[model samples]
Target: MTTSKKRKREIDDTQRVSFALSDQPVTQLGPVLAHFPSIKPTKSTSFKCYKTQTQKPMIDNEDMPFAEIPMLVAGETEAVDFYSSEETRRGSLGSRYFVGVHNKRTGITTLRAAPLHILTHEVKALKGLQPAAVSTLQRLEARAALGETFGTKKAKLAIRAQERNKVDISAMEGVADHLQESILKNTSTLPSKEEAKASADSTRLIPQYDIDALNSSDIYPLHNMIPKPEWKALSISAYMSAGGGAERVALLPFKRSNWINDHLAIAFASPSPNKTAIKMLIYISTMIAFHKATFKDINKEVIQQKLPMVPSVVIDGLLSRFTETARGSIEARRTPEKGTMLLTHMFALCLHVDDFATDTSVLAADLSMEPAKVNMLFKTLGCKVNKLTQSDLKRLGLPDSAGEVKRAILKTPLEFPKPRTRRRA
Candidate 1:
């Protein structure tokens, strides 16, 4: 009671330590101790503790790596674990253990590996296992016994080398005799070359109308003047059969107007008014042949004047009839071979009758083909296709300042170039 307590020592506010305050936690710190490098913990310091509640058990009851897991019924327990706790394994054995789910309503087990399982409920027992009502076991046994003897019999019936080597002269003789008889019959039935030629000549319809009497006005004179009997007998197929130069000449009249009038009349006429309209258009084409205008140009003019329209298919078919199609080209436009021949014949006829050559442009326009292609066709026909010189223009009665014009002139005893041959290496 008598000892006096020393007064508690008090530190000054100026000498006390202070800390900075923040609302958010500090995520990063500057490299203050980075230069001192890190040291890994030893085995003693990094020891694992199984006693801890945070540590997982050796075998974890985790979900398997599957899109869906089989759900158990309310009262039912899950299936027993497929893997042992002692075994150091990863992933799952659920796929192997749970083959499939059984549908109670359908009574069908829908399996994951159905293809591998291959359920054969439809396959019946072998005949040996269960004999048919009609076939008794004794009969089956007898058949089985006969199989060996049948195989042996087949083997014995097979021809040996010696027997196979022997020639059957009688059979060969019979075959030869049959062949000889057939040959004799064929030869007897066949007509002689001269007889065949005579028959062909008789079948061919000779031009009945006088060529001298024909004029430009007579567009399809051969078909128009000839009777149906003779007209039908004028075989285009026979003319085309010769092909090459002869075919070109024979088919010239067909390209003019005869072919369409004769054959295509039925095609156009089936649809009534088209026939008359198409024929009028063709007549107009013939009338305006000297104008150097294309069929398309004519069509355009007709359309502008509110005339009957021709179908594109009909026009295409007409073009195909008078043109040779180009092979192996992106632009499948046809070459105006038949058309050029037709023009050539018309030009030659004009030269014979009117005593003058025709212009290439006029021929091209008449055929509704390019003038360049028409000129090429003329050259192929052994004609001289040349640009109009001043003299040529003057002879043709064109003005001195007339633009470039190409003319095709026929020469006597014309020599044609050999056809080009494609070479493959």
Candidate 2:
């Protein structure tokens, strides 16, 4: 087993250094370097930015491209090393970027540090660092990992055994009959009746919902149609709305609503007092106020931060629900067909999977759905969850490396359920 370190000072890897640089050297400017044309250019007093410009070819109308900075003598690595070796304020732009001075005649390039924006961007730490997991496990882990237990070897062993299998054990059932006598001998060390009574009485069972106990958020009603940008980016399903007017709007896929409401806050801001949108706003707002208090895991704190026109996802659900529940009529009508149960169910999958609704079942049993059923659903809905082939992806013109979320909504084997129509009001 040999390492590169064994072949130390490997000179062959170093690029051949040009022998043209005199005692007075050239400086490199932004990607290009200032260079002499044919013979070295006459000295000028003007503010010469060290970067180079192309010179016309000696022959035809064609102009030759300027020489690029050499990788070994003067590119990203050399720039980085030079900055690292310098004794100055750490991580300055001068440490990173350089103006290049190229000498076409001598075939040499010199790099000089230049002031530039060593741009800093607030790149959120990517989520993949942890891998995709549902919220249920995240919460369960949070509790179990942080939970406190009595410091006892017996307790630790019991937990380990429970993890292996949920079972009850009796010492004498498997072990020696002498274990019973050992236990009897230790009975005298047990706590008194008062201690036992005190422990039993410590737990109180009472329910209280104070005025202050309200959860969820306060927000205006959301539009019945999948309102644009309210929930931020709508999923690929948004285009599913193919009918003419608002009826087409109702068919926008399940992911849009689920992502906003289940993933975020849902508020219902009212429209004008007499308007249906207003009524929707009121109903959703009230529902949000109720659900936030009851639902186990929403970030209610995030729900309250107000946006311009739309309520957060928290409130959006309520508004949509209220309109559906109220029956297409605020004044007098039937369901306007803003959305469908199938659409809702698809998004529900996202919310449930994210909340880890399926995790327990997956852990206990099998997660893979019946392939027959999946194929049937695809046949019924005329869609694909994973058309897992390079050619199919090329046909769609979608990138081969689309995200899980994209795959979830686009590639999902969802059937467009037959639309139900109401008797004309």
Give the CA lDDT, 0 to 100, for residue 101 in model 2: 67
| Candidate 2's TM-score | 0.17
Model 1, 257-285: lDDT tens digits are 33233333333335343333333333233
Query: Which candidate's lDDT is highest?
Result: 1
**Model 1: CA > 4 A from native:** 1-344, 350-356, 390-397, 422-425
**Residue lDDT tens for model 2, 105-199:** 55567655444312111213442375443343345445444442543676567656655783334433434335554775699678897786545
Q: Give the C-alpha lDDT of model 1.
A: 0.38
Model 2 stretches astray by more than 4 angstroms: 1-225, 229-314, 322-381, 385-387, 393-425
Q: Say which candidate scores most in TM-score.
A: 1
Estimate every model's Cα lDDT from 0 to 1.
0.38, 0.33
Prediction 2 global C-alpha lDDT? 0.33
